[model samples]
Target: MVRSNDNITSIENIQQAFRGVDYICSKQIATTLYLAFRLNKPILVEGPAGVGKTDLAKKTASFLNLPLIRLQCYEGLDESKSLYEWKYGKQLLYTQILKDKLNDIVREKNNLAESLEAIHQYDDIFFSPRFLEPRPLLSALQQRKGSVLLIDEIDKSDDEFEAFLLEILSDFQISIPEIGTIAAKSTPYVFLTSNNTRELSDALKRRCLHLFIPFPDAQLERDIINIRVPDLGDSLRFQLVSFIQQIRKLDIKKLPSISETIDWARVLLLLHADCLNMEIVRSTLNVFLKFEDDIAVVNDRLYELTQQATKEGHA
Candidate 1:
């Protein structure tokens, strides 16, 4: 049997490893991840929401048996939050506790000039490792056994924050003003997901490998539905996926993604639904479609959708 560490040996190995963890992935995803591992490059995954971009990093960590550290990005994110910050409260408490010791050192000096110089040595202790608070990025780099560092939703962050990541993405190191530079103990497997809310910078894009995960096609969606909602009967599963595929075709504010399909399937299973019917689809329409306008649009075509999906299920 091949060890888990050998997952990077080939793309197939990565696929098998992900399968072992119950994460079904396509050849493109497996290949990109394999290349990222071999080249030590971060993967930039761009896609619409709920297409498994975040889950990929989590499952990668699960299969690899590495700690997963995630930094959720949003507007106004900065280095102090994602990377590191000093523990000011702890430093203040230390100052109070060491007041006598600090005073004794200052008094021990013969003159004012010498005392001030002597206190500088103790000043270094306040800014040392003990006072440093490691955030997700720094915590990932500090892992002795390596980790899966997921920078989730990079597009949600500001341009400056994205630029801030370039140094770590390129060299796996971060520079601190007082502490100087700190390199990774072991290079982490990095994944940055984007929802395409905004266009990313070209310079930021250059440092990493890129991948896009669109909504799965019929066959792939079927396979995913099978894996994720296994207890759903074949007839119901077929009808459910077919209905979702049809729904994606319509003009709507939000199309049902894979996650919604899984949720609908599980809901059907709980409700003891064996197959698709007009009443069931009508009642459960809200499970997948979020907008009232979208639901109304689907309601207009309710008969058409139920007939089509049921025909496919029967076939």
Candidate 2:
């Protein structure tokens, strides 16, 4: 949504914005981003992990020529970490200078309290270098040029952190007790991603333009894999993605997402496996399935799928 000379200013521009990648299908998503851009609303992308949620934001940033300011969320993230905090060490050094200038110890001690109070009033003077410790959210807001602020995995954060972001979401302003409120220099086009590990409050969802991304269908997945890894052959690409789709059907703790499917294909291509075989499949199985138990269960299913293929004369 961040304005630039790029062609992404309107929905019609999305095709050129993402020129090479053919997998971006959802007309709804392009419309959502376009509408959000026009309306100045933050776009919320929710879906299962690895379904191109985060990639969309990155691609948008690249297309718009704006810096991608990513705030990767986790459990127990606090305001000081997300917004800004004073540099206490620098403040301490200033106090030490005042200590050295005193000729009378008692008078210096009396003035110490007053000096500290005065110093506290101008706490911004002792701030850490803006480059050294700027939080992602603050950095985006402070930039004179519009930026793409990607808040990745919002569901991983706790309620307190979500509450903390409300003011920023509503006003694009972050209030630091030490430095007062820092408003956005250029209205950043915000994109928030969630894996839906848990349901976020309606209050948070209501503040932004919302969209749900799901696993791409067969044709879309094939297009995506081909675009991302062109070295892969047609037969091998179809086999690899079909195998992944079959695996997703079985009950498992972690199924390979679209990103993992691409990785699996890349691994196959790197190993010079032009076709699907037991040796190649077994070696690359670990790349797709993270859990040992999930791998063990899939081994049997893999044999079954291959056997079915052999019977159907498709192997």
Candidate 3:
């Protein structure tokens, strides 16, 4: 644990705290999170695209009252972008200032060798902390009061970047060639999320506590919608969740995610829909089902879906 606020003594405490922050956490989620806190391990969260993988890290930071430092990963992501980069403009500015003082030091040197040696003394000044711009990885490590580091979409990044993160995740430190190795002031709680586009390296997985967030079931998703949109009538909320659940089982191109379900719930609430009638759901199909083909496929079965959802909702 990095600070006094790490008082997450048990799984229930994590659930309670997260619920207080408007996040509904499952037992599995709470347990893994509790273990991560106690063992000081980075969690590698993998799942389908919008199952709240990234939001878990955000909410943890919120409930723990820690600063959230995010690094959105992409293809070709490297250490300089994710860890640190030299403030080249600032360094160049200082180089101009150093040029002004150049004559003072070299003028005192008798010969070329002596002047070269004298100039070398100021070489390190530009590479020092004053000229270094810390990125998310370095910034998280430097947070003395602790922080949450979210590396979103790790699968989108290159394997080299994944390998590069191994050292920082395992040891809570990073090596900078210009500055040597810099250890963390207070270890940050780290969350690395992947949409599972590709298989991750074993080395990277070994260093982290793996967690998979699958699509929520009807009851869980209904609860999520209820909390997120409290003003939504209970019957309509259930109907919408039931509709989403039914569609998820269909052989569609993209199953509607929990977020899309929530979006649909809000849409229904705004439309003042009192029930899951075919007309309203038909018009709002685009809210959750993204692909045209997906929408068309669901549209073909809209009558049966709406009937089942309405029947199940009232049941």
Best by lDDT: 1
Residues 1-315, candidate 1, lDDT per residue (tens digit)? 112356579888888888778788899999999889888889999988899999999999988899999999999989889999999999999999999999999987899899989998778989998999999999999998889999999999999998889999999999999999999999999999998889999987999899999999888888888888888899898898899999999999998888998899998999999999999888888999999999999999999999999999889
Model 3 lDDT per residue over 199-258, tens place: 999999998999989999777888788788999998888888888889989999998898
- 1 or 2: which has the higher lDDT? 1
Q: What residue runs in model 1 are displaced by over 4 Å at the alpha carbon?
A: 1-5
RMSD of 1: 2.2
Sorted by lDDT (best first), the order is 1, 3, 2
For model 2, the superposed segments whose C-alpha errors exceed 4 Å read 20-25, 98-133, 307-315
> CA lDDT of each candidate?
0.91, 0.78, 0.90
Taking all chains together, the TM-score of candidate 1 against the true structure is: 0.97
* Model 2 poorest 10 in a row by lDDT: 100-109
lDDT of 3: 0.90
Per-residue lDDT of 256 in model 2 = 86
